[model samples]
Target: MAFSADELRVLRRALALALHPAPLPADEVRECLQLAGSVDEAIREAGRLRAFLLADLARYRTALPGSATGYLELLQDALAAGYRPQPDDLASLRSLRHLPLAAALLARCQGIAERSVRARLARSTAGPSGAAVPAAPAPRTRLTALPGGRADIKPARPAVPGKPAPADDPAKDRPVPTPAEAFPPRKRPVPPGERREAS
Candidate 1:
């Protein structure tokens, strides 16, 4: 349905009231829902409808301006108090806080490596003279050339137990026989009446 500019304004007002601490009377909420279509629709479309209201919030606020930012600040305070409004955020905040704790725990465990009571962290991982302990570089995989000039090595895939290969290839990708000598002929057969002696 096409909502007019006037209808949009009324819907915006109704959404704001739904979010308001001292909302409009029950009759007003129901009236807006009827205009909006239904309760399910109003709830489902709350975010969009709320955004529309927020976009034009200044216009409505100017009509009755009373420090609305105060409520937003209250929401921030609620976050600090650990009264999480969303269940999904509980794990996130806990993980965020845990990272610092992990760093501190690592710092505490530094003493276990050093026998000194002072529990000093090593400036260098090597000797007491502050010499550099070279980090062991990762090993490199040398690429050796195959029989062919190409570098890519196509290894045979590991075979499954039940299914076996159909044909035997003495040499992979090398033809069964070269073009010059693919077939060899056999001696011709003779009839019983026509013997070798008669020939």
Candidate 2:
């Protein structure tokens, strides 16, 4: 996407004309159109180059340790071309990491993979329009018949900054047993001989 000095000058003039809505000379209009065509061609060529690099990378990856040197080189080039490292690329690099170059590439690929995953997770969690989705509100508690024989819905307690709300705390809903309820007294049993004498 590097433009020559001549192309940059044409682009600048074109931009100025676009902003000011001024009529251009016949030659200038022709030059602007030619520049636009050149830019489009460059974009198309870049896409084709990226596709070719990816295909080559995949082939090199499939060849594994045997193509470690070539694969590493191709991978570096592909990365420069804005190619995202695939799982196959990561695995290939991992297997060939005995080589110093492979080890470095593996670290680089791993970082790219982690960032890609985080980006995907962030996108998935976002709303359709890419805005963050708001959390669902907590459910309200329903109270049984009151003194007036009417059931009521209780509002959920507001969450505290440092502490969990009552509904979120499992221990809050459970009733604690008293000592007597926890451990009931056991009756003493009489001896068999004593029971027979009493009978």
lDDT of 2 at 117: 96
lDDT of 2 by residue, 1-73 (tens): 7999999999999889888998789999999999999999999998898888888888988887788788999
Residue pairs in candidate 1 whose N, alpha carbon or C atoms collide under 3 angstroms: none
The candidate that wins on lDDT is: 2
Cα lDDT tens digits for candidate 1, 1-199? 3577766777888767668856478877767767767545656686565555444433433432243344233323443433323322222223333355423423433333233423243443655667645578657989877787554545556777899854434365566686557666666988767896687
Q: In model 1, state the lDDT of residue 162.
A: 92
TM-scores for every candidate against the unseen true structure: 0.17, 0.66
lDDT of 2 at 162: 92
lDDT of 1 at 63: 37
